[model samples]
Target: MDVRELRNCFGRFATGVTVVTWKTDDHEYNGITVNSFTSVSLDPALVLVSIDKKAKACQALENRPFVVNILASNQEPIAWQFAGRPQEKLTLEWEETEVGPKIAGAIATIECIPWNAYEGGDHILFVGEIKAFSYNDKDALMFFKGKFINN
Candidate 1:
């Protein structure tokens, strides 16, 4: 199948939007938009995120610790900011955890250390060992057919 067809097939599965952030040296970097996140194992409290192998964010995450910010429904603007949109500048407040950084307004935040990575198509699947986590009883930011939708 062609790439577009593959993308369409994958888009059939709805997903939540998240901004995965990480630090490189002293500089902080983040992926503005991602739908490739999932809980891996509850026994060990592991999570996984997939990023394009060629993306700068993925490159930055290599061998580095990171955090996943599960956005709230109202965080569409933040999602856009991370998705390379040229718009009014936004400054997000965040807190540091033992493993990584987390956005303050996120519905949930998980800090994790890099556990392992595997090559998959044009992307890399990163498994993380959860170090810290937080959650709020708020609606989640969702993605469908390339757009964020409130549910």
Candidate 2:
């Protein structure tokens, strides 16, 4: 099967949008939009975010603390901005956390410490041990069939 066809097939599954943020060794803030995030374990409070091998943030995430900002329905611009489509000097609102910067209006924010990394074909699966997390009662930003949806 063609790659695009396989991708489209995968897209049929609706998933929440998230931005994974981390700090560099120089204290620079970096983030990337991802949908390949999920809970891995409850006993150990673990979660996972899959980053494309070629993405710059993939390298930054190695052995670092990071936050997963689960986008709210109104945060599509934040999603696009971090996804590498900067819209002319967009300013992001952030709240400082012990782990990293959390998007101010995200429906949920999960802070984690790097636990393990694994080979995932063209992507790298980064598992994190959850350190802290919080959530709000807001609609989530979702992706399905290659488009963002608020529900």
Candidate 3:
């Protein structure tokens, strides 16, 4: 079985793009673009995001609070920045939350406190208890077949 082919098959499912953000102890803000976020439960208000084992955020988010910034359609630049192709002159307006910082213009922001973790192949599934959430009326940024689309 080809792993690349498996990845491509998985990519066929459309998902909303998100920037999983957390602040370091030294006050530095960090983020990574992810499309593997999902709602887990309602009674406990749970959510989850998967981070690759080798990704820096996998370490940064350990036992720490984080914010899920659901990208808006026009926020492709921000997504590219966190996805590793950072722009030379990227300017972002940040909204500081108890958990971390989020892009001010995100379609929605979910503030969460670390709840649970589990290993899944090359990724670690991090679950969070929703502490707070906010949203705006706007189109979402979506990922499908390895491309970004506005929806």
Candidate 4:
């Protein structure tokens, strides 16, 4: 199958939107919108996020602690912001944590340390060991079939 076909097949599965935030070696903040976040192991409290090899945040993730901000239904603009679409007059609300900076209004936040990274074709699969986590009762922002939707 072609790339478009594979992408369409993958898009059939609904996924929660997340913004993975990390600081570079120079203390520069970096964040990228990701939908490929998943829980890896329970005993070790591990999570995984796939980052495109070409993403700016991909290089910054090496050996860095990061926070995964699970976007709430009302945070679509925030998602788009980190996804490389800058909005005019947008002011971001950042909550500094021991692991990294997290979006202030996220429904859930997971703070993690770098555990391992593996080659995944065009993407890098980063496994993180969860150090802390919190969640609220808000609905999550979801993506399916190339569009955001409320469930």
Candidate 5:
């Protein structure tokens, strides 16, 4: 299928907005936008995030731990900022946790260590072992079709 058709098909499923972030050599690299995140297991606290094989962040995730910033409804701008405007000069505040760094104003933040990885068509599935979690009581930022919406 073509890109638009594929996107339209995938858009049927609404998903929460997430910014999957990782650090390397004292510098932070982030994906800004991701919806391919889900809980996998409760026994081992495993979560999976599917990253495009060609995405810059995929390279870092191959061998490094990262942070999953689950955006709060109020943080929609943060989602857009990370999604396509990384250099837009927006102020981002975050705190450090046992596993990694997390966005300060996010609805929920998960710190994960890369536990497993596998190729899936055009994406790489990064299974992460949850080390810690935190949350702020608020609505979530969601995405549908080609726009950002509230959930």
Candidate 6:
């Protein structure tokens, strides 16, 4: 099947949008908008996030801690900003965590330390050992069929 067709088929399964934030060795903050966040294990409190091999976050995450910020429904602009589409007049607030920096107002936040890295086709699968997490009861931003949806 063509890649586009395969991607469209995959898109049939909707996913929540997340921003994977990490601190550079130089103390800089970087992130990427992702939809491939998943809870891998409950017993060990592990989560997984897949990032394209070429994304800067993929490189920055090496041996560094990161936060998976589950976007709230109203935070679409933040999502777009991290996804490489800058939104005019976008402003942000951040909170420093033991693991990394977190974008405020997310529906949930998962702070984790890098546990493992694996090679995946065109992407890097990062397994995180969850160190801390927090959540609020809020609607989530979602992605489906190439567009953003708030639910």
lDDT of 4 at 4: 98
Computed on alpha carbons, the lDDT of every model, listed in order, comes to 0.85, 0.93, 0.94, 0.92, 0.82, 0.93
Off by more than 4 A, model 6: none
lDDT of 1 by residue, 8-106 (tens): 888888899999987668666555478899999987999999998878787788888899999999888888888878448677787877777778899
34-125, model 3: which lDDT tens digit per residue? 99999999999999999999998898899999999999999988999999998878898898987789888999999999999999999999
Instruction: List the candidates' TM-scores in order.
Output: 0.92, 0.97, 0.97, 0.96, 0.90, 0.97
Error of 4 at 47 (Å): 0.2
Model 3 TM-score, 2 decimals: 0.97
lDDT of 2 by residue, 1-151 (tens): 7999999999999999999998778887889999999999999999999999999888888899999999999889899999999967667888999999899999999999989999999999999999999999999999999999976
Better of 1 and 5 by TM-score: 1
Q: Residue pairs in steric clash, candidate 4?
A: none
Cα lDDT, model 2, residue 45: 97
Error of 6 at 87 (Å): 1.5
After superposition, candidate 2 runs with Cα above 4 Å error: none
lDDT of 6: 0.93
- Give the Cα RMSD of candidate 6: 0.8
User: Residues 17-122, candidate 5, lDDT per residue (tens digit)?
Assistant: 9988777666654554788999999989999999888887788778788888889877777887776765466788877666666788888888889899999999
Task: Report the C-alpha lDDT of model 6 over 24-112, residue by residue, as the tens digit.
Answer: 87888889999998999998999999999998778888878999999999999999999999989988899999788999999999999
Q: Provide the lDDT at 110 for model 1.
A: 88
Clashing pairs in 5: 32-82
Please identify which of the two predictions, 3 or 4, would achieve the higher lDDT against the true structure: 3
